[model samples]
Target: MAEIVLDKVTKRYADGALAVSDVNIEIADGEFVILVGPSGCGKSTTLNMIAGLEDITGGELRIGGVRMNEKAPKDRDIAMVFQSYALYPHMTVRENMAFPLRLAKVDNATVTRKVEEAAAILDLKAHLDRKPANLSGGQRQRVAMGRAIVRSPKAFLMDEPLSNLDAKLRGQMRTSVSRLQKQLGTTTVYVTHDQTEAMTLGDRVVVLRGGLVQQIGAPQFLYDHPANLFVAGFIGAPAMNFLPATLENGSLSTPLGTVALTDRVRRAAEAADAPREVIMGVRPEHFEDASLVDAAALDRGASFDAQVEVLESMGAEKFAYFSVEGGEAHASDLADLAADAGSAGVPDTGSQVVTRLSAASAVAEGQPAKFWFDTDKVQLFDPASGANLTYSAD
Candidate 1:
């Protein structure tokens, strides 16, 4: 295992279009790191640069404390698993897994031992004699992984290896891949466009956009305290609701009504020198049915009535959707977020909010319902700069 470091790395095309900016990331030995972003967001380009598949326009690339800016892919001692599987139909599972060892001119007995070990680790011991054509999608992916494992390279690079499988199969394979990586304890760098995979698979996630590093930290840290409007909107599942609000005298006035800022929030806003006009963000899970909250809890939050446009019963919980009277929040940063999330063409005349309520609550569709949101959980952002005003290094 080896540590990888990218110091002020940059990639620029002949047309002078920058694909990756001066991004710096230090991946520890045996750590699993994921590169995640929307389409054309330079994730794949960054991975390819590390794999020596693309040239670095500027800055240094180091692995195991050795400068590798000009080294060839074969000399980097890294194995890559692509999305296509790229297995040979004519070769059996054992033969495919042992091909790398044979290419290095290892003795026959050593090759058989290595292939058998990898097959056992991947739960493919029974299918060693079968060809790639006879295996399922998940099985084929494992075969590709086994081929990489037998090489015993210094690191593993996987690029959306499970995208071709069905949803259920992908989930199953996710568990398998995670277990295998932990057992082997190899340094890994995975690239994917799926936020779910990025959240569940890596020790740390790197969120990128427009060839720049947006945020880098644990998944829950980014979810709870995003650094900017784009990171806040991109990390959540249903996405956080953004509403235009006016801040005055430590209070926020919005369509939902006026909310008195908590002591913590007030201090943060004052420290950051927040503007008078700001954007307020609240997650879906943060809202609750007012009828279900305790009296003491109700005293700490603000409540409002809205007509429920749609309700979805998810067995464990319910999702209530409502539309507020005010028009959609207008800002260039919001527009960029919408475009990156594939919602640029969606027309919205008013703000829409989703609330996750307990299954015991009785919220009906097309009826007025009372929803309460905790004031302390709210996040405030500056409209002009898109910076989270309440953010702290801690």
Candidate 2:
């Protein structure tokens, strides 16, 4: 219903510790934007600042083209759905949805109409008489959503609203939330630590790190062309694989073997004055079982043999893990990513390269299998700054 803007917004605690620093983002009217990163990356703090739940130490916040820096949470005219359902145990679904209107002293007839409309939109019409205790997890979350929607606020701030649901239920709720947001067309800013949710649920994604803005773009753009080592590792499932390599004569020598740089990559790296020591990045999807590759297509790529340490059959595809000599690529940026993954309980598994192979491929664990990787899809990153040397703005 309205646009929101954070102009150089910053937050600093009394102890001189900064939670968010100089963040600038604009949410167009009815646009759904996501703020995503690892825990303590300041996404939730940024959302809290916007919802007026936290105070800004500097810069400005504007909603619907008006300053909101000094306004209270209720006065900001926004609705927030938190990780917790936070429903009143004593209230029925209908009463919970209508509570905001009741507090505003809206007439009974209008409140009833609005509550009914919200229930219908959320597919909760059948459960309106039920209490939170009687509902399933997903249903209770929908009830929470219904409560927020009845207010018809100018914007919605959601902080990991699907965090508590089971995996299947979370997936279903994601679809439901996407549909509901479009149907209502309210400006939305969602905060999440899940990269899957960040990729699937929003028009644009704003990636943050250590309270700093990393990159802002469409999900696919960030996936295909990350700005730095951290963004490259953070945006994808299984993350992008990094290999240490030396660049000379437009060719790279890596653990995977010698790779002739593609023209696009060569030019970009050359223009950036790339160092001889660089990090080569390749996405999981870019690699495939060599036997499955066409002979004609084989001319455009290269192949190497490695023993598969583990093989996971996923029906549609197979996830094959391999150990390469020289271990995982080492850099400060990469170390930070590893630390985050460890803290989040993601398996370290030592130095493994995860590749998505065709489901029909007969590769098995502990067997030497040839794998082919597309040369043109390779990306080069600066080892020191963690900046993508082969990044293209176009």
What's the count of clashing pairs in each model shown?
A: 0, 0
Candidate 2 positional error at 279, Å: 1.0
lDDT tens digits, residue span 1-394, model 2: 7999999999999999999999999999999999999889999999999999999999999999999999999899899898998999999999999988998899999999999999888899999999999999999999989988999999999999999999999999999999999999999999999999999999999999999999999998999989999999999998999988899998889889998888888999999999999998999999999999999878788899999999999999999999888655668788888888884345554467899998999999999999999999999999899999999988
Minimum summed lDDT over a 10-residue window in model 2 is located at 343-352
Tell me the tens digit of each residue's lDDT in model 1 across 237-286: 88899999889999999878999999988999999999998999999998
lDDT value for candidate 1?
A: 0.90
Report residue 113 deviation for candidate 1 (angstroms).
1.3
Instruction: Give the top-scoring candidate (lDDT).
Output: 2
In model 1, residue pairs whose N, Cα or C atoms come closer than 3 Å (at least 3 residues apart or on different chains), thus clashing, are none
Q: lDDT, candidate 2, residue 212?
A: 96
Give the Å error, residue 154, model 2.
0.7
Candidate 2 Cα RMSD (Å)? 1.8
